[model samples]
Every structure is written in C-alpha cells, then in structure tokens.
Target: MLSVSWCATAQVFSPGGGTGVWRVFLDPIRPGGPFSVTAEQRIANAVDRIILKDVYFGDVWLCGGQSNMEMTVLQVINASKELTLASHYPYIRLFQAGLNKSLRELNDLAGIAVQWSVPTAEILGKGNFTSFSAVCWLFGRYLYDKLQYPIGLVESCWGGTPIEAWSSQKALSKCNLSFNVTNGDQKHEATGPQEPSVLWNAMIHPLKRMAIKGTIWYQGEANTAWHNAEYNCTFPAMIEDWRKAFHQGSEGSTEIDFPFGFVQLSTYHHRVPDDSFPWIRWHQTADFGYAPNPKMRRTFMAVAMDLGDEKSPYGVIHPRYKQEVAYRLYLGALAIAYGEAGIVFQGPFPKYFQLKNSTELRITYSQELAVLELSKDIFEIRCCTMWNYSSCKWVSAPIVDNFFNILSLSLEQCQQKVSGVRYAWKEWPCNLKKCPLYSKSSKLPAPTFIIPKNDHL
Candidate 1:
C-alpha cells in the first residue's frame, strides 16, 4: 500500500503494481529539517525494511558549469584558510554528480560522485577539479551566513564542456540547433564532452524530481570557439526549458521562473588579444550586456573581469580568486532571489551618450562612478566619413574630464565624426582591480560594452 501524509491529512492506496515497484507523492514541506524516512514491506512471514537518516529540507541550489565551477577549494587562493573555515558550517550540505553522459533523458542519476555530506576540512580540500567546488562551496557558505539556515548545493559540472552539452534537444531546437556531431565543428576538436544533450541526460535530467530553489552557472568559454554568436538565443532557451522541466517534475514545488545567476567569463591569455572572450561575455546576458533583461528575466550576473588570475598554477584561464567571485554572486542572490530591498548588486552601466562637440563626446553612467587611480586608455572610438567599417579605425579616446556620473572623452585623434564607442573591449583590459571605471557604492567593475551609432545619440 502507498500512503501520503502531511500535518493531519492522510491518503492511502492499495498495492496495485505487478512489477513490485510502488510510488507515492508527498506535498511540499517547509525548509529546515534533519528528519528521517523509513519504509517496510511484508509478504507472509518475511519482512524487508529500509531507512534514510539525517535528511534535510532547505534552499537547494544547482551549481552547473565547466571547469571553473568544478575547480576545487584546494586550487583557490588562501586555500588553507578556506578549508579550515569549511568546518564551521555544518548546515551547508554538498553533493556532486559523477561525470557521465547519456544519449537519452534519464529518470535517475547515473552516478553519485559525492553523496550529501556536511562540510569538513578534508572534504573541502579534496583533489583539484574533483568532488567539492570552490565557487559553489563559498557561495553556499555566504548564503548560510546571511540566511542562517541549511543550504543544499548540488554540483553537476564537467570541465571543457560547452553549453550545448548541458542543454536539452527541446531547448536547442528553439535556437535552430540540433544534436549533430560532425568533424567540422571546431568547438569539439580537442574536447571530452561536446555532444549536445548528453550531460543534460545523465546529470541534470535526473535531478528534476528533486526540487531546486535556483541555479548558478559558470560556462561559455567552450562556446567561444564557434557558438559565441548563437549563445544569445541558446543560453536563454536552455534556462526556460530547464525551468519548465523542473516545475513539471517537482509538481510545482519549484518556481517556473526561478532566480538564475551566473558568473561572466573571466580573462583568458593576458598578452593574446582576442574579441571572442568579450563577445561571449556580452552574449552571456543575451547581448544586453546585463541580466534581468526582457530576454532573460529573473536573472542576475557576477562580473569577474577585475579578478583575473594571471599566475594561477592550473592556468590563467582558471582564476584562483573564487572567493571574490562567490561573494559577488551572493550579493546578486540576496537581491534577486531573496528580494532584499536597497541592494546594489550590479555595477554602473552607460545610461546615455551625447556629442558635446566635433572632437568631444560625453558619456553618462547609470549611477555615481568612481575613477580609479589607474584609469587610462580603456576607451576607444571608431570614426569614418561614410559608413565604411573597413576604412574606419579605433583610436584611443582619452578621458579629458570626469565628474560624478559623467565622463568626457577627447576624440581629437579621430579624423572624422565618431561612428561608435566602446570600453574595455579586450580579453585582458587592465591589471587586477585596476579597471578605470566602477560603481562607487557596490565597488564592482563596470562590464564591457559597445554602443554603435544610433539616431537618438
């Protein structure tokens, strides 16, 4: 027999399964638990029993992404101190999904790399790129410090995997993409798992039944090779589909439009100049250069351009300063997910631009700006007599005046009228925390952006 109970209500059902498997549904329960569940079966004189102990109910967050999210605490900066602090938070539970892929959606996880366990120094200081994730752990720890409750973190991540691997076929179809692995795809050349929907099948789909409060991602580097342009559509579609699937699977326990958060792509090679990284950063927010936009609603972003690690043992592409990244993410979560009032989670953005004169352009920010001591040639302008992109070249637009929220630029180097303007348009724009512009209140670096010529401007 199957039974459902909550408070004073109870419903019972007769055992009607011939395959020897029975399922029961329970209503949603409040958070905060160290409860237990037991099951028993009897046939004639024989009896069988099973029990699960120390189970908890809390805000469950699914941390998904590539290597950065998989980077362990042992590989981060101040590793010893971080590992020592892990023992203080017993309410923060951790689970990691093993690396596996399937061609079809699965109802259960293929493997469990690390079962739900309380954090400890030994558990947190595991092998690099292994069970415990630095970003995920630090984020959960910060949340527990604020909410003062249990926080469940499930890590489903694989290094060098593209966003396609995490997204389903239904989601990809919306972006005009399919699961067609070919030799011509450059993104799959030197890769492990690049096939679409494989990781989703084995890792993400299995967790649909387990209701999650939200998700945080740290990917897009793998897609920079080829799918950077399509990410504006593919990424948003994937979020929408994941929300719908989880809602249906959990029977409305999870919100349809839960608060989604992600870390923007950090710097790669410092000396090597490439536009791919900047383009992918823009596309990460659906090309709006920020989150919670119309295309990607109920979302927040963490900018990591200023926290670049150029001398990391793992690689420059993988920054070791995950503590700052997780702290920024926690701020966003507090504002967007928890609905805390008067939280400035994001940095200042460009509100508008004005042509003060033929050789001068004024850019106004969305909030009060802080001019760092190291501010320099981080701004550029494209100028041409006609709309000929080939003839127009980008020249340094030095800051002549900066007051409060307005920044005035000198365009004397331009031979003709400026066609567009851009800021910090480089893989490595400046030294660590030396970015020219930032929000005075939040202390967060302004995200890279490009504004082309428009009629209103």
Candidate 2:
C-alpha cells in the first residue's frame, strides 16, 4: 500500500476572496478543510462536508455577557425580517459554545462542543433560539457589510449571571473585594453562578489562547440591582485581568490587549426608588475613564439609556430593540477598531460644568461630539424638582451657545429649586425615536447624565 506523507502546516489565502490568510494544516485529510478555531472548546464534533472550500479570513469577536447578549434572533424586535436577512449572509461564522461549569480552570471543554455554523435559512431555523447572539450578530453583520471581512462570533453568555461570577478570583483578590459566603444575608454562596470566578474558570479560561480582534459585552443587569457601587472598580479590574490572562504566555510577542465595547443598561421601568441602574451606569462611565492601563485600547460604551421598553407590566427589562443596540455598537467599532477618523463614537457627555450664577448651570463639551438635535425633540433637558430618581420633569432651556456648543439650564423659573439637571433620563418608555442628545458626527445618542448636586443652585 502506498501512502502520501507530505504533511506540513501552511497558511494561505482562502477559497473565496477572504480578508486574511487562513491556516491550513494537512492532517491526512482528517481534520476537515475549514472551520473557526474553537475558542473555549476545541471542535469535538463531525461535519457532513469534508471539503470546506468557503473559508475566509476576518476578525473573530468574543461576544460575552448576560441574557441580553445571549438574546437570539427569534427574540429580537424584528425577528422575521432579521432572520430572513441573516440567511443571506454566508461569510459570517458563529460558534455557539455550549455551557459547562468547572471549579477550576481547564485547558479544553469537557462536554459535547458544538461545531461552527454559517447562517442560512435552514441552519438558522435549526438552531432557533440558540442560533446566535442578536446584538453580536447585528454588530457582526454591520461590521461585515462596512468592513467587508469574514466575522466569527464566540457566543459565551448565561442569563441572570453576575459580573462576580464572570470575574476570576485572582482579579477579585487584586481588587480587594470581600467574597464571604454568609448564611444570614450574603449566603449567595448557595448559588453556583455567584461563586467567585467559577464561570470564568469554566467558560472563559480555555479561550485565553484563541486569536481574535476584540470583545463586545452586554451585561451588568445583575450587578446593578445590588452591587452597583462596586462596578466602578470591579468592572475595570475585570477588563485588566482579561487582558493579562488572554495575552499571558511565554511568548510576549503576541498582543491580546484589545478594544472592549459594551452596552450601558437600557432604561428600566423601576417605579420604585431604586437608583441601582443609575449608579451602575455612573460607575461604568468612571471605570472606562479610569482603566488601569493608559496605553491599552480604551473601552467604549453604547448608551442605551433611552432604549428601555417603557410599556406596562415593567417586565420588559430586556428591550427587544436589538437592531439599534447593534447600530450604536457599530459606530463605536468603526471609530475604535477600523480607525475611521472624525467618527463621533462618544456621545456628547459633559466635559466640564460651571456655576455661572446661583440660578443657572452651564455645560461645556466638544463640538464634534454634540449629536443633540433640539429640532427633532430627541433630547429632553429635565429640571429636578427634588434630589431623587425620576423626579425631574422636562423643561425648555436655551441652547446658550451652539457655535461654542454650550448648554445653559436656568433654575430661576422652576417652582422648586433644581437639585440637578438630567439629559434624556426619563423612566417611562423613553424618547426612543426622538432621543435628542446624540453625537453630531456619529449620530449616536447620548447616555443619561446628571450634574453633581454641588453644581446645582
């Protein structure tokens, strides 16, 4: 019997006009032709098509977060249209890593790992709710169309999981957080997801070696309602640890410190006096600005403060408008990842505030980032009647200066002395279509913001 044994690892351009060179390891025609290198779990399944000719090279993104990030195509607002359209895009590849928990970090998955799938009507329908991450998909779709690259998305998410579970114990230790599992009150130890670093140990540890462009996250709901205050420190720490862990290896040549983009919690219809979400958003903003690394890529936020479903029952904590959520994320990716100059990815956040007088407060920001459109009634400036959540009501104020891009809020006319001013911070079905505060260049809506009480008259 004669056998060809000319085996060698080679990298070459893909079958179609792909973006980058693909690696081809000739293994006696045993390990199929083309497939995404599994992130968490190495491919442990079989495929019908032995010869995968339609290989492409592009960016692979780790789409990690909670339920919202895990929300599937069938669950999005425009499911039928979105799913129908998803069938057409063949270049976008998805690896839905099945869930498995471990007490310690492992090199590979222990359970049956699902292989990669390129979306089509049949394949997508088969996967159904487990098809792909909606926000991640839409984000990838946008990137694929604009950047014209083969996109791979790693779907790693669990509903109702906290940031604590996703973080590593090493990271938590560095942050100096107390993880005492008590019985009286903090007995969250009873829950497996709350166990410090278990999720990261099990789900994320194996993927440290995988190559990729960056990560897109949509979590923080669980952390908001309780541990809101800690996000300012923990969130940044988690990112830093992730950067070090993923890029950690004997070879220092590989750079894994990648750009991270995440969604700010959408407006919640919390009728109660809970400021958890607001404080969480505040901490998130602070974390981004104050990340430990100065040279690493900066984290970006997709402000969804105005996107929360405001309909009755208040059960719609997870908004169905995934299309816009992804659109906003795309704006960030284009500006940060693709290096498109002059993109207003960051919305008009208050850069500086001045106490002009006793009855007036002034806001200063970059003109390029001023996406606010008063003409469209997208932005609503509210004067707080009391120093409380949702106590502010919409009020008209002069655009003190547009050429200079300054906003002045006059408290003299208010019957109640204004404690603070909020921008697009309504609780009820917020100003979705008419959201006023947006970036002038990127057309991205501004996140909810409130000046400090010290700034008030």
Candidate 3:
C-alpha cells in the first residue's frame, strides 16, 4: 500500500465547551497497484471518509424554509414512534445548519456539517425542538421509509425571517424590492429582495460541493404572505443557483440535474374574509412544472393545499398532520426524482388562457377530465370557513369552462365587472370534493387563475 494524505477543515462544537478543529485524515492506498476496488470506488471511498460521516452517500435532501422548515419531531404529535422507526436506519442522518445572519461573506462554518440522521427515541423523547423544519423532517422520514436508501438532510433556515432578511445586500440592491430590513438599527429599503436565494447563499452555498439528490422546500409563508410580489423570476433564480452549485464535479465540468422539489404553503388562519389569496398559491403551484432551470432542466412542486385543515386554530403558527405532508413530498420525489411509476404527482393546473366572447374566459390545463362539466352543471360549490373543517357552506358554481370542453366560463358573469377570477384563493386551506383530476377531496385547492376585472384596465 502507498501512503497518501490530505487535510479537510471542519469546525465541531466541543462536547465540553467551545469549538475545535476536526482534522480528517485519508488513509493510504495502493499506487497503480491492485486493490479490488475500481478507480471510481476508490475516489468515492475517499470522499465518503473525508467529507460526510454516517451518511449512505446515495441520495441527499436539502430541506429548507422558515419556522416550518425548522419544525422538528419532538413538537409534532405522536412523533416518538415515527422518529424511533427513523433512527434504525443508520444511513439516514440530519445535519442542522447553525444560524448566522450577517452581510459579510460567511466563513467555512456557515452550512450544516452533515446530510441527515434518523432520530433516536432518546433524541425524540428529549425533544429539544431547537432547529428543524417539522414538515421537512417528516418529508425526509417518508423518503427514508419508502426508498430504504441512505438519506441525508441539510437544513438551512430561520424563523420569521422574510425574503429580504435572507438575501444579501449585494443581491438585494440589484432587485426592485419593497421590504424594509434593519441592519444594526439602520433600516434599508428595496423592492422585496430576491427571496430564498438569499438564505441559500449563507446557509446553502458552502455545501455546494457535497453530492445531493434533491431539495425539499417549505417556505413561501413569509414571502407570499408578506411580500406578495411576483416570484416567477426569484423562485427560479434560487432553483438555478442550487442546480449550478450541486450539479458539478470538483473541476466544474459536468452538466447534471437532480430533482428539485418543494411543498406549496398550506392554509393558515385569517380573521377577515378575503378572496384572491390563491393567486400567490397559483404562482407556487405553477412552479411545480413551470420553473425550468436552463442548466439542470427540471423542477417540481408538491401540493399542500389539501394539507391544511379549515378547522385548525385561527392565527396559529404551526399546524399538525405533518406525516401527510411528508408522504406527498415523498410521492413527488418517487415519481419525479426517483422515477416511480403510476403515481399522480399533482392535480390539473391551468397552463394557458384565452378570452372568448368578451364575457367568458377560456383555460387549458395539464390534466384532462370530465369535472369541468360537473363543476358547471351541478354547481355544488362549497365555501370553507377557516373555523370549520368538518363542514362547509354550499355555494353556486357556474359553468366556468369555455369553448374547448377543456374549460368554459360565463363571459357575461365574469365580464368587464370581474377584476380577477380565482379558483381557490385563501390564506388557509380549502376542500374541493371529487375535483376533476384528484380522485378524492384535496385539502388544497385546484390551480387558481387570475383575470383582470376590467378588460381594458
């Protein structure tokens, strides 16, 4: 065996007190001589030993977002068994990204140290609830349970931090943002700073070299509810950044695209009645199939419209039933990421729109079904109060489809008087039964459409 050595620097919090250096030493290997392993295998062994520890090294997930992303097992209901089952998998590990928010370039300790870990009963029982995304944790759990592969989760997020706070001053300066951020008692203003991409810089950028299978996002509550800006460009920017960072060899040569998946924000509580909230959700839903990365060339968004309960406490911050959220995210990963067959990843979404007769709106969608007819004829539309999950109020739904049996709408009803027509728009979740594409009622609403009320305005 020929002896070779290399040094990798890592900062580890000492169990006794302050931080210390973690020096990684690569063992000797034969030089141009016989080891049963192939060159690729040898390199992989080096990487596994030098970089990640206790990780399976196959597929890894970068779980991101705000408080939702940081929500963990202990706080969730009945999470003990779930986490206990998760801990058995030696391959699955969770690495927490230590929080750091500063304008300066972050040093090496900015990102999470590892990919992910299975939670132990002891860990769950102790219930630190310090730094984990509840929805993200469950989602990773689902992936580990189904794939039975080594899964790693890198969590980088902060609670109550808006899109602006997460962005760098440099990036924020370029964009026309609207939020006011205070840096050391001095307030700086911009149009909404590019969302998410900011956090990605401090928290995620350092981890770029690490091999990852995909990312699971649970943000948008802050950006959508707070900024309400058109995120079409910013959301894709964040995705592209991740793709460029992770989809390369050390030499920066390979053009690789892993699956990028995210969860749409579930409904939350609101006091007053309002419509049109779904427009932002529409933007998020559109991201599933729409946000194309020119580099990696693929993106996906998991639906959470159905995940929220109309009955959930109003104005409450965190909602339960994360297992379902995890399972659906897994389904998206299974079908879109890992190439599983026969799974429905999303319901019908509006793809194109046209105006006919000046009184109706024509819409085309990705999924085809007979529900357009049902929604028009029966019109048994139900309105959900944020306070009532067990029941709903019946309302009239008109035949909204136009021209192509694809989608028809009443041009007269939605005519010049309608500012915008939204399918399901609310801060909280809604239930639509027997939707055209979904076999069962979904907690989330179908993809909503936005049309100007005044035609010429």
Candidate 4:
C-alpha cells in the first residue's frame, strides 16, 4: 500500500507507512503485486489530492443544520434573479461537508474538511451542492456585500438529520446517551442524549485557533422533539466550547467573547385545536434564551411565527420561505454583529403584569419598545390583561376589526378581579390588526404580561 508523508523537504512517497516524502512509484509487477489502480481511479485520486492541498491554505465559515438550511436557490423564489445578480466577492469563499455522525473522535480539523469554491451555477451543482445550507450562503453574501471581507461559508448539514447524530460520542457519554455506533440506526441513536462535543471534535476542533469573528447557528428543530433536557445544557456547552476554541484572547486575561446568533424556529407547526407536542414548540422557543457569554452575550433570535404560510406542507417539516429565513438571519447579524442599534430583531415581550385595585390588569414591558407605533390606533386601552402563562405563549396587541388594535389589558375575568393585560398569549387566529405598520424588517410582538397572584405591580 502507498503511504503519504508530511515533511519540510520535497515529498517522496515510500511503501508501508514509512516516514518520508511521498513519491508516486509503481510497485513490482509480480503475480501478487498490489499497484493495480484502474486508470479512472488514478485520475480521481490525483484530482482529489490537488483539491485537498488547495483547501489546506484557505479560511472557511462552517454552517450546520437540517434541511431548511440545506434548501437551495432553485427551491426558493427568484432563483433566476438571485443567480443573475450573484456577483460574489472573490475572497468570500464557500465550502460544504456531509453531516455524518462519528462515534469515534474526529480529526482535529473537521471544520476545514472541504475545499472552498466561488458561487457559480456550475459550482453549486457539483456534488451535493443542491442540499447546501442556503441560509448560511445568504448570510455570507450579505456580509460580503456590506463589509467587503473575505467570507467563507462551510455547509456541514444533512437533510432530516437530528441534532443528536451531530454531537460527539465523548460528550454524549457524559449526558448518558446511547446510539448504535454502526449499522446506521438514526432513529434509535437519536433517542439518547446526543454525543456531546462531536461537532467540536469534527467541525470546531479542526478550526481551533483560527481567527473568526463569530458563529451563527440555524439548528435545533431535531432537539425540539425529545431531547429538551439534554439540549438545555448541551446547547450552552457547545457555545462555551466554541468560544474557548476560537478565542483570540483580546480583552486582557479574559478571552474576547464573540457574538453567536441563531435563527429562531418559526411557527409553521402551529396546529391549533390539537395540543399534541405543544411542548416541542415551547422548547424551541426557549432555545432563543441561550446566549454565548455575559459580556458579548450578543445573541439574537428572529421570530418567524407570522412569516410562515399555513398552506405550506406540515408533513414536510421544512420552512418554504428560505430566502426570507436567510433575510431574517441577516437582520439579526446586522443588529447584533454589525451593531446597527436601531431595529428589534423580534417583538417586545411583557416582563410582569399586575392587578390594580382589584379592577384592571396592569401590564408592564421590559427594555425598549419598537412597535408601539402600532398601538397608536384606538389610542384606547382594553380593561383585560389577555395572557396565557400556563403554556408560555406570546401575545400580540389585539386589534379590533379594521379600526382599532387593543393596546393595554385591564380585565375583570379572574377568580378574583383581574388587574393586568397581555397580547398574543395563546395559539389564536391571525388578526392583521395585531400588527399595523409595514415594518421594513421582521416585527416582534410584545411579551406576555404577568400578574402577581398577591400584590399589585
């Protein structure tokens, strides 16, 4: 067998795993001689070696997720227009990898497993390019346009793959997970705590010490199914490990923390009147709460609850408006990564609600309010705090008919007298009245209002 070598001097290939420069020489032509590669195989091997060498000397952006991220330009709208307008920044490169699970420790450089390429129709259709993570490409393209930097997008996603399969065996062992290391049982394997640090070992470990601004994630739909408990810790742990690995140590002894943003799973699965798996949606929503660090905790979640169409296939489990998804991601990046400081990536949420004098529900808000302009309509306040705290739902301001959208909640429908109000707290029908203005970007509704059972707020 031919053996490859890495040395400072010129490469000279030797037989039997010897340590020296690798030189391509034919083996002895005996009856049992082993240098019998077909002409096609030899050509293929030579081409792959050339590509591998090229990839060794470049930077890449790693993207991992399920099929939504894997959706392609042809699947979404304006494919022709988008391709015609595709003038890629030369330095901004793109790479993709298979989303295979590894029971064993992956190579240190898992993140840089593929070669970078320019965005051309031919390049995109080369391998499994149609399944490349589209959201990542859109985000990178946008960044390249605005910043004019050398951006590299690495698509490391698989269609219909669960988050557990992508995790590391070592990490999963800590979480008490079990899955067949062999025999390809994805379903049986996904039932356990995902192998922890698998992505780090395969994707992040390889790129450790590589200078990257930050990472943007668009996954967790699989984790939403049955691994909520494990995800609670695994998600946070993954963020920390990535931080430590890519840490450049800029802020004194404290390593410089980078912004890690993610796309919020949209509300396409809302099947009202049927309460099956409601907890899954809730867990997906909670993932929005995870941030990288206390300092650069610059994490944003784009709410896609209203963006999805009801007619879209629920059985498919894939979001149809992928371009919109990418745009929403870009919105978060612009606000958090680029620091626009002007827009709200999602709607405002109610912090706490209170009953006042046993009469009306007093709802209070947290942080800065963005869509209060929508509240200018009736200018009149409702007397009831419309909230659904039992299931952790979001409530949008209620609008009445084409005239007035309800602003505040002051209700008299509690065991005692209700004193606070909320909006969009339950799974309800859409009322365009809920939102008034045509937001230039994604509009997040206010939070659920909370009322103390005892005192007034």
Best by lDDT: 1
Alpha carbon RMSD to native, model 2: 8.4
Task: Kindly list the per-residue Cα lDDT of model 2 for residues 56-145, writing each as its tens digit.
Answer: 556778888888887777777767787899767778888766677666777665543346778764434344346567888889999888
> Between prediction 1 and prediction 4, which has the larger TM-score?
1
Candidate 4 local lDDT, 192-247, one digit each (tens): 22443344456445444445555666666666555755664555555555565456
List model 3 lDDT by residue over 154-197, tens digit each.
Answer: 77777766555554444444455433333333333322223333
Model 3 regions more than 4 Å off: 1-55, 110-118, 122-131, 168-174, 177-201, 247-256, 274-277, 285-297, 310-317, 351-365, 368-420, 429-445, 451-457
Question: How much lDDT does candidate 4 score?
Answer: 0.47
- TM-score of decoy 1: 0.93
All-Cα superposition RMSD per candidate: 2.6, 8.4, 9.7, 10.5
Ranking by TM-score: 1, 2, 3, 4
Q: RMSD (Cα, Å) of candidate 3?
A: 9.7
Positional deviation of residue 236's Cα in model 4 after best superposition, in angstroms? 1.6
Error of 2 at 66 (Å): 0.5
**How much RMSD separates candidate 1 from the native structure?**
2.6
lDDT of each: 0.85, 0.64, 0.52, 0.47
* Candidate 3 displacement at residue 140 in angstroms: 2.7
lDDT by residue (323-371, candidate 1, tens digit) is: 9899999999999999999999898888989997787889899889998
Which candidate wins on TM-score?
Answer: 1
TM-score of 4: 0.65
Identify the runs in model 1 with alpha carbons over 4 angstroms from their true place: 1-16, 19-25, 44-46, 180-192, 387-390
